[model samples]
Target: MSIIMQYIFNGIFDIYSIQSNYYFFLTNLQLTIIVTCTLWALCMGYG
Candidate 1:
């Protein structure tokens, strides 16, 4: 009853948090890669 509902709610929350963290990490990684590429291009006189 209430315990089962609580467990379900907790599971959903855990999953949501994990998903958000994963997306955050992915965004940071993409930004880092883009910055690195841009710097490399500038160094090579392409920019």
Candidate 2:
């Protein structure tokens, strides 16, 4: 579980680091929002 979280965070940071344009930034922002919602739902379900 810790490893999975680490991997997800790393992926998020990597995506942020690679963003170099407005379009890419907007897409990444959308992706981040989606991932955040999914993680929140999983936590609420498990908690």
Candidate 3:
């Protein structure tokens, strides 16, 4: 029973870590897009 509980806890931790990583990656991607768009606008003499 204890071993099963341990495995469950480990699984939950792994899932949480994966979710955090995915969130971080998405945030970085959004930031990159924004920066790229801003640069493009500046280069085009719009901003």
Candidate 4:
């Protein structure tokens, strides 16, 4: 039970860290560009 709790805690911590880093590195403009590029790629790939 304790191990399971630790695993869950670690997962939450990892997600928080990842999200923090993502926001820290990418500004609004960069995020918009990235999302646009990703969507364009997906559209091109699938359609």
Candidate 5:
């Protein structure tokens, strides 16, 4: 039960924090695309 709660908490954390290191050069539109793509992938992966 604790493990499951931790997993849920981690998933919530992932949704809040994007993988930020690689896309520093991206413009706002490009960053929005990357973030939306990541978020969509995360939703699909979690669901």
Candidate 6:
């Protein structure tokens, strides 16, 4: 019973870490895209 609980807890922790990393990666990607688009627009002087 203890071993099963340990495995379950470990799995949950792993999943949490994976999700955190994915969120961080996605936010970074979004920020990069936004910055790139803003720069492109500024260069084109569409404003």
Pick by lDDT: which candidate is best?
A: 6
Q: Write candidate 4's Cα lDDT for 1-47 as tens digits.
A: 99999999999999999999888777876988999999999999999
Instruction: Give the per-residue lDDT digits (tens) of candidate 5, residues 1-47.
Output: 99999999999888656655334545666989999999999999999
| Residue 13 lDDT in candidate 2 | 88
* Model 3 lDDT at residue 38: 90
In the order shown, the candidates' Cα RMSDs to the true structure are 1.8, 17.3, 1.8, 9.9, 17.0, 2.1
TM-score, one value per model: 0.90, 0.56, 0.86, 0.55, 0.44, 0.83
In candidate 6 the C-alpha lDDT for residue 13 amounts to 100
Per-residue lDDT for 47 in model 6? 57
Per-residue lDDT tens digits for candidate 1, residues 1-47, read 99999999999999999999999999999999999999999989963
Candidate 6: misplaced stretches above 4 Å?
A: none
TM-score attained by model 4:
0.55
Runs in model 5 with CA error above 4 Å? 1-26
Candidate 2 lDDT for residue 28? 92
Which digits, one per residue and each the tens of the lDDT, describe model 3 over residues 1-47? 99999999999999999999999999999999999989998989963
lDDT for residue 39 in candidate 5, whole number 0-100: 100
Q: Give the CA lDDT, 0 to 100, for residue 19 in model 1.
A: 100
TM-score ranking from best candidate downward: 1, 3, 6, 2, 4, 5
Candidate 1 versus the native: TM-score? 0.90
Better of 1 and 4 by TM-score: 1
Which portions of model 4 show Cα errors greater than 4 Å?
A: 28-47
Write the residue-wise lDDT of candidate 2 on 1-47 in tens digits. 99999999999988877765667879999999999999999999999
Worst 10 residues of 5 by lDDT: 17-26
